[model samples]
Target: MTHDAHSALLHAALDAAERGWHVFPLRPGTKRPALHGEQRCPGTGPCASGHRKWEQRATTDPDRIRATWARAPFNVGIATGPSGLLVVDLDVPKDHSSSDTPDGATTFAALCERAGHAVPATYRTRTASGGEHLYFTAPPGVRLANTARTVAASVDTRAWGGYVVAAGSTTSTGPYEALCGPEAVAVPGWLLSILRPAPKVSEAPSVATMGQSRRYADVALAREAQTVAGAVHGGREAALFRAARALGRFVAWGDLSRHMVEQALQEAGEAAGLTVAECRSTLRSALNWSIAHNQRRRTA
Candidate 1:
């Protein structure tokens, strides 16, 4: 990297730290972890901690950031989950030319269409290889696991257990450029459902312990309903459907009564401006869908 590029990266790292984002160093011009050794690293594989365990050692301490970046112009890696952030990485194929139509762009557009909502305006970064990273504040409760090509081919998630190369980090192709700087937005309900599916039902707890367990379960289910309630917008019906479906899971597990779940959905939907008819229709559809979904899981 050039002296100018090095300065740009260091400045970017500091800025991220100031924003309370946990930042770590990647090997200069590469995505590998800057730290390496037999002891400091832990793992059994070649690309594990011994060489590129970047995610494990990522930190936000200013002193550590300053010391690491000063020794060499290292690329910046942001610890995603630790920072309460999630990133969608839309990537172009490595063999593709920079000017080619980006796969990420095409798939993301399709994703927006399917969700019945436009992408929320927030912080975005243009990657060195002509891809993009859409940043969002991670939702509570669900463990958004990192996955590759799950949303679409070439589209991946850097969730709670992953890291993303920060904007301004330099690579062989070029620097990761910040395209937008707004606060990270919430992940839409449609997107969230795809990233983290509704939990499956489990065997019922003993009847002897039902009283205490039911109280705890009700509180948990109520919180999940609130998560759904937040999904009120252009896709209000779809969002409610997701919420109702989640509630249905509790019913299936015998932790919540169907009447209780329906009451919760009705109240939340009405408060969110949904009509009585719409809420009922959504609830019925969600229950049916949940039943079918569970059947498929059981058979499979």
Candidate 2:
């Protein structure tokens, strides 16, 4: 990309960010190439040594992290990753309606709410002439296209000022507007209200009784690490590290509960050729036995 083109892209990205759209910057070497040789990076700051500055910023001022959505003249993009969703592209008709809006935003918001957060509306500059990039949060764990379809179902592309851009395409920047702010129009509340159902809160499980469950899971994960460590010759340690990291992320995201934690560990142990079923049975018995013992003691 020429310097002028790069500069133009940067300005459009900044405009999106200002409007509460999270923007990823794309640069050379900062990301692994997609199938077609295009790469995605954060739009903020410098790209050096293939490390994106936004990654570091995310560690600190995470609010500035771009939501998983993108908009362009001819395409729209959404992110589907463990960390969060992001919009990568935007382009559609200006007159859109509730039935024709993008599904990515609704799904993204729903997932974020489940994970105890909210998704914000984000916009970007269109690659097309005098257009703007618009995006919404995507649901965690779902494929990007799925989320996009969800948004599209509820929105009427012709009624609103935009249309749902196809995924994996590029848009021109000439027609895009580079300004987004509080005054910018958002997905109306009535539409959002109808599209996304409220999340249900479940009763909390007993923590004391859950201790054994958690411990069992931890032990299983540790054992799995040991096995992965053994199998991978030169990178056994690295394999273990990766497993540990995955576990940590699961825990951080609150996806692993006492029961599920144990199951995860058991899976890990099985992967390592350990006696997973035996360990799991033993753990279950010990926990049940302990719970009975505790009840007896309390009554006495």
Candidate 3:
């Protein structure tokens, strides 16, 4: 990267940090983190006491930001959870096959119209793919989890356990540029109502304690996990995706616990030589699709 490019990215990190957003380094020209994973933890410096994940490693300290960005022209990422942000990601579909589906921007606009409120203007960024990101501040005392397409078709959210590429970062396609406010407005109440998950009524049954009839779910889980674990090297991610989608029906039916199924498949995916990040992304997307499409209600 040129000196100007390096300076631009460094300023981006510093700028995000200036807004009180916890910032971290993404690989140059990529969204992936530049930091080493747990498997490669050196157990020195920041991890001198213990290994801190990227989320934990994210910082708002200017000194730390400058020190880290000095080494390379790394892109900037904002840890949404620590920064108390809830960003709505409006995404465009890839390829021509899914042309019928409306883009996230359209769907979100429709949702806003139906909700009887104009889209609340907030800090907005234009993503590299020509989609928009509307940044919102989380309401105090309310902790929201990241969601995929929960708000509307093609609309996903980032909260805890999620991060967004900040403005000034560049990808092969284009740069993520800020179009609006430096301060993200508070999350609109109407939007929050849709994003929040309903309160749990009862705990899901564990694998060992499942009733005889529900045992089918456990059997299916084991079978799918096996398929994922033993998948061919080239098709491991696809296998993991298929397994997660297949078991999603069981989770949607409430015959299987989502947590249990995720853990099983995650272990299998890792065992099959997939990275933890790869497994999580695929697993989350697949399961979200399955659960949303196949929801089942328990007897009263």
Candidate 4:
């Protein structure tokens, strides 16, 4: 990164802090949290209490920002939940395939049209890759779940428990640029309604509870596959690793089949705009890792 880019990042992080967004340092030229060695957890599982928790470490405190950025020019990452914000990540691939869906912005516009809601003209950022990030104020008392392509095949949401690269963060392609001032508007009610997970229906008193439980699990598994299909922005390999781990847990419990998961990943990856070669390699590696982890846990 250049001197200008480094200065831009620091200024952007300060701007985000001024907007009440909790900011954290991402590695220069990468999106990964900048914690190292004992401070960082390098696996799919939960971190130890004292380790550097990415979300917990994120802060809006100006002193912390100065201290962290003084060491190195780190990319700025905004914690969505802590900031009471939600982000709609939109991506448009450089190359189109026979099966590619509409670009993220187009898909998002269509979703809003269908729901009879207007897209908020709030804080917006242009991504490093030719994509966009739309920001909104999160609703009170509602914890929105992050989803990939829940609305359209190219759109994704970063909600509670998620973070986004803030405007001015430098990626390999270039620095993220703001499309508007750092002001966020409330999330649309229709959008909030869609974000909520539907409540499970009660099983009939006369029906077998075992059968109902199995049905619910099947529905959840299908939903998980959908999330993987729509995921973009998050590193492709990391996303695959997480999706595979979730599926593998169900397979270990005998609630799902390994073959089913492999096939589902293939389809989800394609829908998410990942190349076939990348998808296959990621799945093979992730599945092996997940299965071994499961076996070790069971034996332990």
Which candidate number would show the highest lDDT if scored against the true structure? 3
- RMSD of candidate 3 to the truth, in angstroms, is 13.5
What's the count of clashing pairs in each model shown?
0, 71, 0, 0
Best by TM-score: 3
- Each prediction's whole-model lDDT (CA): 0.74, 0.35, 0.84, 0.73
lDDT of 2 by residue, 42-102 (tens): 4334443454433222221123322322222111211222123333333344455655654
TM-score of 3: 0.68
lDDT of 3 by residue, 1-300 (tens): 789999999999998888999999999999999999999999999999988988899999999999999998999999999999999999998764977888999888865664456788789999999998999999888889998765555799999899999999999989999997757999876677545544342334432334743676777788889998997655676677777877887798777889999999999999998889878877897788778866764432
lDDT of 4 by residue, 1-300 (tens): 577767878888899999999999999887888865453466433344455577777889888898888889999999998888989899885567744567888877865654455677888999988799999998788788787755446778998789999887877887688998458898776566446654323332334355654565477568767887776543343455567765665565565678888888888887887778767766775566556546521211
Candidate 2 displacement at residue 250 in angstroms? 29
Query: How close is every model to the real structure, measured as TM-score?
Result: 0.62, 0.27, 0.68, 0.64
Query: Which pairs clash inside model 3?
Result: none
| Native-to-model Cα distance after best TM-score fit, residue 66 in candidate 2, in Å | 16
Better of 2 and 3 by lDDT: 3
Q: Against the true structure, candidate 3 has what lDDT?
A: 0.84
Residue ranges of candidate 1 with Cα displaced over 4 Å: 1-3, 37-53, 93-102, 203-300
Residue 292 miss distance in model 4 (angstroms): 23
Which residue runs does candidate 2 get wrong by more than 4 Å? 27-146, 151-182, 201-300
For candidate 3, give the lDDT of residue 12.
92
